[model samples]
Target chain A: MAEKIKILYVDDEPGNLIGFKASFRVDYHVLTAVNIPQAINYLDNNPDIKIIFCDQRMPGKTGVDFFEEIRISHPLPVRILLTAYTDVESIIEAINRGNIFRYVKKPWAEADILSSIDEANKFYTANSMLMVKNEELQKAYAELTKFAYSVSHDIRGPLSGMLGAINLAGEIDDIEEIKEMLFLMGKSLTKLDTYILSMHDYYSLQRGELKITNIDFNKIIDDLKAMYMVISKSNKIVFTTTVDQGEVFRSDEVPLRLILNNLLSNAFKYQDKKSTNKSVEVSIEVHKNQAIIYVKDTGIGILGNHIGEIFDLFYRANFQEAGSGFGLYNVKSAILKLGGNIEVNSVLHKGTTFKIIIPSI
Target chain B: MDKEFSFIIIDDSELDCFVIQKVIERAFKNLDIISFQNANNALEAIKEQGVKTKPTIILLDIQMPLMNGFQFIEEFEKFSPQIQDCYTVIILSILSATRAPADIHTEFNKRIVGSIIEKPFTIEKLLSLLKNMGLADEKIVLSGKKLLP
Candidate 1:
């Protein structure tokens, strides 16, 4: 059952407060205060109170004045003013200045009061939803600004380097020097290509919906092996994989593939150049609707301080190798979309291992 | 022309460093050119070399990981007056002059920063800038080429 909505009623007369509570206590969690000061205390203590009812004939302060004072501080609660028919001017003031939602007659029937509570509760719910959406919109706007700045910096940084190289290529006459410039230009082009590809992945993950299907670990392992075969063979790094799947597993294939592809590529990219025994190991186990996978590498591991930030967008831990810095961020996003989690362990100059646990949809 | 100055190129991009070095080498012969891929290393080198290094021009890139160009300047400002006077810093960036961060225009940075040069730096721009600074003669010769008429 849903929790009862809280209601607060303020009146200078103690008997009237008890009567109001008795009438609505069954339907709402009723809170009563005999004066404006006591009512303010209740409001400060019970922030979740959704409706406030106050009588206009209170001594020293009227109901409309109390609502007006709290209009800025406790804006979330719906304020309803109770007044005698002779006090028509107070009703108008309540509507204009106090921002009251409705006005109840001083001698109210149970039916009219119940209907007002229902309507005011609906308004409160909608207002709360709007506030939440406003916060989300503001956060997204900030992310968009940062995204624009980073996109411009990453794309132009390389193009300008290539242009500079071309300018120098024209001026220099030495063949060896020109060859070196061409090599650097080639490297810049490669970096640009990698950046564009990862950008495409980032957008797809953002806008695409998950397409869940039965996942085949064997096929995924085969594709990964085939993809890295040439490079792994040439670099003399051993690539190994073991898969144990005793039952059917279900997940979104696209994101799962993205996660493994990024992790494997990093494992290969960050290998110690002089280490003759470079290796990457992958092991997968599926049982009882869960998949646990590990990808371990004998590479120059990340520094301990940088591990916390490696998953952030456009964050790079090491500058020795050319990276788009989108790889791990995209991997984390895809994993989140699949309702899974990832963990990493590494030691500098030794090795690094990534463990991922994904539940079947 | 008689006073030779060393060049310190601090940029994370190797290709940009290579291009800038070649452009400077083509325009002038046998001037000392030092390049660092990281800004922290560059700052350490400046501290270690002290005043023994030649009078230098530091071409700085704005956006880099760990330490950016502005942060580099903040550290550079802490050097002694003699060491600070030996170097002239210029912002070398892909951002246009108008889009550069407002911090670049602060009075503190203004004292140390010589000028802002957009990316794809050219020999023509470098030569004109040096002439305006009175560091180069009005007519300068390219290496192994005739003097500009």
Candidate 2:
């Protein structure tokens, strides 16, 4: 069942307050105050009060004055005025200055009060939703500006480098030096290709819906091994995998592949070049409808301060190697879409490990 | 043409550094060139060399990881006048001209910065810049190969 809507009623007469509470307490969480100070206290304490009713001709202040003051302080609540005397000037003032939604007579009908409450609640709901969407639109606008700046920098940075290299190639006469320039140009193209692929993955992950199916850990691990075989062999890094899955495991294959590919690529990319005993280990265990996987590598591990910010968009820990800084952010987003959690453990110059656990949907 | 001056290239991209070094080398005979991949490391080297370092023209890239070109100028401003006066900086970046000039006017130290050069720097641009600075008028060598004598 839906929760009851809360409403506030303020009056100078205690009898009127009690009667108002008794009438509406069954359908609403009704709060009543006898004086202006007490009414302000109720508003301060109860932020979720959606509808407000104030009676005119109070002791110290009029209901119109109270509504006018709260129009700035508590603008989200719908305000209504209740008065015994039918003064046309004050009623017009209440509508124009006090911003009251409706004015009811002293001898109000039960049906009229109920209908006013219903309309006021509907206005409150629509206003709250508008505020939420306005905030979201502002946030997306800021993100889009930052995204545009980063995209230009990432793409142009490499192309400019290539142009510089090509100009140098024309003036040089030594074949070996020219060959070296060609090698560097090849590296730049590779960086460009990697960045484009990451952009594609980012777009699809944002727009595509998840497709869940029964996942076979062994088959996925074998495929990964085959994909990375040549690079692992050339780099002299031993890659090993072990999977202990005795029960069924289900997940979205695309995101799962994205997560593993990113993690495994980083494991191979950040290895200490001088380290002779380079290795990567992958271990997975599935039980109790959860899959726990670990990807460990012997690499130049991340510094302690950078671990917290590694998942942020366009954050790079080091400039020693070329990267678009989208790899780990995509990994984290994919893991979140699969309802999974990941933890990182690392020691500088030693190694780093990522442990992830995902539950079957 | 015996007056000696060194060139310092500060850019994070190794390939850009290599290209700039080659371009500078081809234009001048036996000119000293130093390149650092990190801005902080370059600052450390400058401080270590102190006032004894040779008169230098620094080619600085704007977008770096830890310290940017403007931040490097901010640090450079704290040096003694004797050391500071020995170097002049020129920005080398891929930033658009409309934005780069405005940033240089507002954020950079006017006295220390000589000018701004867009990326993919060529030898002709470098020689033209040196001529404008009065450093190419018989004081600096022009390698005599496809260069204005």
Candidate 3:
């Protein structure tokens, strides 16, 4: 059943307040106030009140005056001023100033007031939705500006480095020296390409719709291990995984892979060179429709102060290497889109561990 | 005799470090240039070297993965004045239009940053800047190529 729409009827006359409550009590959560102070009290207490009706002739405050005053604090509720036929000029001025949604006649008919309440409720809902969407649009716009700046700076920085190497390569004739320059140029190109690809993933993750399906944990784990095989060997870090899933787990696969790949690569990237024993351990368990995953790494761990902001966009916890700075941020966005939560634990020079719990869709 | 100085290249970009290293190597002989991709690692090195380190010149990048140029300077400020005053920190970045070096120097003081140089820098600009700061006394020669007319 739909929740009852709350309505507050304010009138100086006690008889009118009683009549208003008696008429609409069945359909709405009807609240009655004898004066402006009582009406203001009701509004303050019941924030969810959708429609407000006030009598034009009150002790010290007119209905229009009360409506205008409440516009700032109680703006969400639709305001309706009740006035006599002789008060046409005031009603016109109040409506012109956009203080009230509509004005009801002094001797309001029960049927007429009921229809007005229904219309006012719909208007209130639409207004609230617009406000929410506007806020979202503003936030997205801000992020877009940041994205533009990041793309240009990150992409051009590498390109310029490659350009300089190429210029120098043309002037040098020695094969060995040219070979070294070519190697550096190749690395610059690779970095630039990777940044572009990550930018693509960031956008798609934000705008793409979730395609929920049965997720094969074994296959995903195999792919992850294969992907990081070279890096693990190069860095001399042992990689291990333990998966325990009895029944088939279901979730979106693309984002799942995105999250795992980023975390694993970071494990390899930030390892301490001096540490003799470097390793990454992955554990996944699925039971009772929830998949719990843990990726722990014996790497140069994040600082205590940076732990909270590590997942924010373009926030790098360690300056170990030049990266897209979107890896953890994208992981966080993908996890959130799947209605999951992730937590990080770390100590300086020790290691970092990430725990994630995602309920199956 | 010219005062000998070492350098710390605190940039996340390996390519930027490579280019800068080449420039330095080509222009001068027998100079110590230490490069770190991460600021924290550089901080560790600075702490170890302490006052024994030479009058070091730091080429710092503004936009880095962890601990940007400004954040690194904030950490650098925690060192003793003896250690702090021995180094010249210069902001080298592609983000010149967005961030002003003078503004940062005013905010952090000249003790933190000597100046800013926009990226895609040439050896000529770098050597001249060093000379102006009185860090380079020997005439810089760029691989049989004259950087100054």
Report, in order, each candidate's fnat: 0.68, 0.54, 0.54
Residue-level lDDT of model 3, residues B1-149, one tens digit each, is 23278778987777778777766655555778989888889999999988964698899887887577878988999999999988898888775645533454455567668777777766776776787787765454333135222
**Number of the top lDDT candidate:** 1
- TM-score of structure candidate 1: 0.83
The TM-scores of chain A alone, one per candidate, are: 0.78, 0.80, 0.88
Model 1, C-alpha of A145: deviation from truth (Å): 1.3
Residue pairs in candidate 1 whose N, alpha carbon or C atoms collide under 3 angstroms: none
Winner of 1 and 2 under lDDT? 1
RMSDs, each prediction?
4.1, 3.6, 4.1
Candidate 3: misplaced stretches above 4 Å? A1-4, A12-18, A25-47, A56-69, A84-98, A111-115, A171-178, A229-238, B1-8, B38-57, B74-89, B98-115, B127-149
Candidate 2 segments exceeding 4 Å error? A1-49, A54-75, A85-100, A238-250, A285-293, A357-359, B1-3, B138-145
Candidate 3 structure quality by residue, lDDT tens digits, A34-136: 9888889999999999999988888787887888888888889998878785556886877865478877787999878988998998899999999999999
Candidate 1 on B1-149: residue-level lDDT in tens?
44378899999988999999988876677888999989999999999989855679999998888778888998999999889988998888788677855555663366588887888887777777777776666556343134221
Ranking by lDDT: 1, 2, 3
In model 3, the clashing pairs are A319-B38
Kindly report which residue pairs in candidate 2 clash with one another.
none
Chain B TM-score per candidate, please. Answer: 0.87, 0.88, 0.85
Q: What is the CAPRI rating of model 2's predicted complex?
A: medium
| Predicted chain A of candidate 1: TM-score | 0.78
